[model samples]
Target: MTTSTTPAVKSSEDIVGQKYDRCLADLLVKAGVGFGAGIVASVVLFRRRTWPVALATGFGAGAAYADCDRAFNPARIPGVRVLEKKD
Candidate 1:
């Protein structure tokens, strides 16, 4: 008698969830960096007196970074095209 071994495969939902988690983590890091940058810039340029403006600027920067990052990332599966024969 022989025993068979098979690897466990992840479901589509699980795979998608993992991808979403990674994207969320990346966005969080980007937001933190943007906030820090805004704080530094505000202090250096405005003598640390523009709290409201700095907060808004940081939020906008973070959102823009996330949008661009999502747009530029390529899909896991590449597209395939079939060639036509010449008549």
Candidate 2:
């Protein structure tokens, strides 16, 4: 039987880059969950029907808006560092 040797692998940067992108995607999923939860809590607060309720509603709205912004915003991912290790 004849044997042939395989060529050496090229630079792994591409592979690592792909993995990094995938990890960022995972982080996005988690952030989305948090943002969604905040929105739900905000809605619940809005339903209370009083000044105190209104206060809570405002607080909740603030938190929900912040979280939603984080979830939808791709810019914040760097702060969370989903691909720090890969880089």
Candidate 3:
């Protein structure tokens, strides 16, 4: 997800906004591809063995979760932290 600091928004409000956007639904279906580029790029740039590996693993896992959501919607993991905004 992206982060922005807008004074008008509260901490919780930010999460709500993301949730309102169907964060999970949107993230899913990319087959760990949408964000894969970022992971690879970061790893290549920093070249930090520990951090790079960790990020790589995280990206891989996230991609898997997203892919799973596509095949079978990821059951609400709970505490999604998304604010789930109201229209």
By TM-score, the best candidate is 1
Best by lDDT: 1
Candidate 1 local lDDT, 1-87, one digit each (tens): 988879789998887787777766766776667677777877788778677455856686677566655544554225844458999
Local accuracy of candidate 2 as per-residue lDDT tens digits, 1-87? 988989877677876666566556655665566556555655676563345444544565555555555655557755665555663
Error of 1 at 74 (Å): 4.5
- Output the better candidate (1/3) by lDDT: 1
Instruction: Pick the winner on TM-score between candidates 2 and 3.
Output: 2
Name the regions of candidate 3 deviating beyond 4 angstroms: 1-48, 74-87
Per-residue lDDT of model 3, residues 1-87, tens digit only: 989967674587676665645545545534355446546766688664456555655675677665545444334554554466899
Provide the overall lDDT of each model, using Cα atoms, as 2-decimal numbers. 0.67, 0.58, 0.56
Return the clash pairs for model 2, or none. none
Clashing pairs in 3: 15-83, 16-83, 32-63
lDDT for position 72 in model 1: 47
Ranking by TM-score: 1, 2, 3
